[model samples]
Target: MPVATPVFDLSHIYKLSPETEDLRVYEKGQIIIEEDNGKLFPPSMTPDMGIGTCLLNERPREWRCNRANVNGAVGAVVIAIQFYRHHNYIANELHELNPCWDDERLYYTARDINIAVFTQIYFYELLPILLGKENMIKHGIISDSDGFRDMYDEDVLPQMTDEYHYALRWFHVIQEADIKMYDNDGYYLNTIPMVNVSLRTGFLPHDENLEKMTQGSFRQYGGGFDHIIDNDVSNKTVSHRLNKIRIKYSCINLT
Candidate 1:
């Protein structure tokens, strides 16, 4: 039942898989983002690229990235796009601050800053909120002090374990079926099924959905941590996939 552990394996999520390196990066430090009538979107995945599964209709709108569209939902996709934009934003700011800095320096520095920002948010913001700040601090998952702490070990290999992978799936219990939308004025607009947006990045740009969803992300309340699991989440193909993973991990000889 202990959710926090000292083991760290970023290779599964942090490191960009080899195949996606070319597709993700453009010139300089920015990730590739598509523009449609002045609006930015994730780069489109090529048809039958065979990286990850996507619906036939979604093939044209699918996002291309390190992990492709594997387990990609609207919320996850939105986060990715935000980071993509953040990277470009940082790169531009760095270029402005240091006019002499070349593309390589700009890219690497911006990338590092962008990654650090993500880590800060993940450890100091998200995890603290979810797992409790005091708990995170006690477990050594985060530090109370703002000062830098060096804990890196060259001997430790970066690899994820089956237990950690399986434990993360517990989050599905809090997955909301409805993705609520709101306007900048704090007015509720409407909601679309979270499942409907899966693998369907095309839907984001249509009718200012992206902007609304971005607003809704913070405004809308996530599913309560109660007995109720969203029907869509419980009955959908995603559930089936999770079940498969459960069975696979269950069968593993922990001994």
Candidate 2:
């Protein structure tokens, strides 16, 4: 018997349903798989952690925003550091919850974890203050205790300086401090992640394409942003000079 040709769709290829909503999905019985991308993936663990492109960090889950447990943070960091140190030549870069820290010897997992826990606290909280290292420290922006502070929390955001308002939001999202040492609310002088996109097409339907009525030329069923010709001279188009018209559609409200 000849093998039947497999019909493929999103469901056919992934052995999933058409209505599946999760962006990451695992195999029905597979033990280790990442749902980062939809497919049966092997562990992407590599000697070089792809520093330039894909990023994943092992946060102590304390510097994480919910609660602080230094010991727990140490365990997570030590595992990552040891794993990365042995395999550093392969992976591009690996970062822990804390960056650029100085502590006692990261000897064994026990030592590393202990140091890492305190480092996590200082990095997440004090590091920001240390950046200013001036009058800000006098104002309590930097403190030995990692107790949560409302002064830095993002609850009453939008009113703070643009830098900090954005910084708080960034911290909440990335779980790493975006800006360091905001004493009198001057920016720490760094770039924040903001994606800007602008797209334009140069071709407008040349000479004769618009004269004849086509499904794509009229307002009844035709044209939206780039879907229509830029030089559209029709009365229903956006540039209709003689008709001062306002369109009303139920799905939205037009002013």
Candidate 3:
């Protein structure tokens, strides 16, 4: 059965329930701080930063937004920062359009639009690669002729299967440990161990780490499509063990 895209909703990004959402708000109307224009991440005032320490030093949290999952990997944090900036940008733009809109309204409107775009990208752009554009079109997942078409189905509730998270684990095979930083002009700056920067926002402030990490986004590549997994992810990260456990317990049950 065909289901609506889950990414369009702000389901996972922010808690829909009033209880959890209330806790996320920092100021009366404003939510937690998300950096604007790829600037320095908000200071780590608490363990929510998920700052982890290593031989070099104790890394501090850079982003002060809702989630601080250190295990999400370095690339995940970088992507989050970009999305965070996007959300803030949209919020400011909405604020300009409707001066009467409170901070909460602006924030949520921005978040909704951001999630919508994110959903479009995944469904239209990313999914085509694996699911095939022709297949998607045939199945009516996407339109054959594009304008505006409503495919919204109210009956289907948003949910995920145990296999969903397990499937995302494939990224771990290609996940790189050392990320190379660069400048706007493509100048090589330095390399940092991704583990060192996890949960530590302070690493972004001391130098050009923030800018450099942003620049690295274009230059860096995940591991190749080869069947092999990086040693760090397999051994040090224990992603392999996790995968085995999931396969043994969860996937088998599904079958």
Candidate 4:
């Protein structure tokens, strides 16, 4: 059975990140939950800059939003995990906060903390491979000919037979880690709702001229209004405190 694409009326309240192209797959209006066509979709996220920590434990809550997977391409899957909510435009809150340059506009808004918690794990896994002597060859992080394929092949993708390779370019790892930290510490503080959007479809149109839709695996983010902190000297010192959190909770969860 072909699952029809869901739609939201798209009000002026919703806020998109890139705002231009297919960078975002969302709809605004009423709350809608659709079956994911029964696919085993893995939720992934790449956060850049925040508390510099991962695996945030927060209260349970619900988020509502629309999602889709456009015509697929190689690595077309965007691992954009998020949380969302919908509401009417806010003419008052707009007047209240008085607004700022970096502020996001929306009366009732959806909130998201990309899967920063997960990406940290991936980065940690690469640490040993990156610092290992034999792993570091002539060019750079060889990453097996398939860009960490040897690490993921056996357990993750069973259908893949061809062995390919690519290095995790130095830029991606650094930038990705930075993004993860930002979300972890509430760098972008207009905390909204949370949902897990997964694009498990392949990177290309099927050989049969078909494309698979994305399965959104929603996860509740925070349930409090506390993530938003008052502007203060300490509040602006998230980066300097990263090491402190690292030292404090570094081993808290190891056991």
Candidate 5:
């Protein structure tokens, strides 16, 4: 089903409410991260929000972040973790540059920079690969030159249409099922079924899983943009059963 996309705000990072944001914050403008058996992991969700459906029976807590447990795929979780770390790293750097700045100033500044970094990656790096750079430039979706392009209109509210939301589902055709793991040295490690990692964030902190998965996220090839849909994506990932039913009904109506 099509859903509305809001403006390019990093709600996923800062969360929707002051209470949730407070829970994730550590002292000195850092997000709360825990050290478990010498490896760093996101702070554990208290009271168990029931999102970690695939988590091991022994592991009751999911990673504490606004959206980390939403899908809980290893790739998604790792990226969240990276941004959490990056935010703190930036906060620390800002403190060093301006020692007089208070925690609030440092935190907000770092958050702004983090959002900007994400925007840069989306526009300059990811979009060019997905939609040909030339096409994006031609459509004015992105600027062709390094100079600033003032396309913003105060009257126009940034909103994503239902059609645009539905169109994004096409990327599922390229969703990879097997998440390959590699070491920092680029040595191939074992592959994990992407299904196994869904909602099973507890798996990331153990046995160098986080580090290996981080390596693989950048190194592994995405599923080919071909006719075949990955079985795990079709059968196991969250919401697949409902999606299957939707597809079935749509086909029946069409036929």
Candidate 6:
């Protein structure tokens, strides 16, 4: 059977439909569930709100953020750490620039800029790799001509097609195991199960997990493109299996 072509570019990473309204970001400067410090925490597990209290022995206080628990499998954790670092970095710059600005102002301003930067990279950088830049330009999906082209069409609804949703899942084939950790000074540290790190942000600080993960990101290579998927992915072990079952149940309810 031939698959239907997707009518929309993949924008669901940032935009959510009415059915996924809960995933929408309500705050201007923050991501959907990330805290001011850029660390994500579960709704049920909040650390003391006092200054420096969010950290346990210099590590991010741990809790179960459902997103982290279910779908965070290594790649997601890396992305989360990337964004968290970027957010804090930008916040620091903003704080230095506007000395009079309060914490909330600094946080939100940094978040807004971070999101804009992410969006720009997503379109200009990632889209080119996924869909060739020439092809995107030819299809009017993107413009080759630079400055300020507003291609916004009010007639087209901002909803993703079923084909688009299904197509996005193909990236799973490239996911790798064996997440490596390294220190800031380029020393080899230890490795952990990417799945094990999920829902345990606190551990990112323990034994220098966060610092090493951040450093190792630039130093390591992702799972190679090959004929076989990892056995863990193929088998859907433990927590992953439960996540799949829940997704299956949700799909059944939808149907």
State candidate 4's TM-score.
0.21
Better of 1 and 4 by lDDT: 1
RMSD of each: 5.7, 23.3, 6.2, 21.3, 5.1, 8.2
Put the candidates in lDDT order, highest first. Answer: 5, 1, 3, 6, 2, 4
Q: Model 5, which residues run further than 4 Å from truth?
A: 1-7, 17-21, 24-27, 48-70, 147-158, 236-255
Put down candidate 6 lDDT per residue, 34-97, tens digits, no spaces. 4434544322233453211112122344433333122233345456456545666776677677
Q: Please, what is the whole-model Cα lDDT of each candidate in the order they appear?
A: 0.62, 0.25, 0.55, 0.24, 0.64, 0.51
Q: Is candidate 1 or candidate 4 better by TM-score?
A: 1
In model 5, what is the error at residue 111, expressed in angstroms?
Answer: 0.7
Q: Which pairs clash in model 2?
A: 47-90, 47-91, 48-90, 48-91, 49-91, 128-181
- Return the TM-score for each candidate structure: 0.77, 0.17, 0.70, 0.21, 0.78, 0.58
Model 5 Cα RMSD, Å?
Answer: 5.1
Q: What is the per-residue lDDT of model 5 for residues 1-255, given as tens digits with 9 covering 90 to 100?
A: 212221244554565444444534645667666777586555665555543343432344334333333334455567766776788789989888988987778888888788778777878789899899999999988888876556657796556676665555666678787889999999998987776665566677677888998888889988888876676676553433334322221222223
Give one clash count per candidate, in the order shown: 0, 6, 4, 29, 0, 1
**Residue pairs with clashing backbones, model 1:** none
- Kindly indicate the candidate among 5 and 6 with the higher TM-score: 5
- Count steric clashes of candidate 5: 0
Query: For this target, which candidate reaches the highest lDDT against the unseen true structure?
Result: 5
Candidate 6 clash figure, as a count: 1
- Which candidate comes out best when scored by TM-score? 5
Q: Rank by TM-score, descending?
A: 5, 1, 3, 6, 4, 2
Q: Which segments of model 3 are wrong by more than 4 Å? A: 1-12, 16-30, 34-72, 102-105, 237-255
Worst 10 residues of 1 by lDDT: 245-254
The TM-score that candidate 1 achieves is 0.77
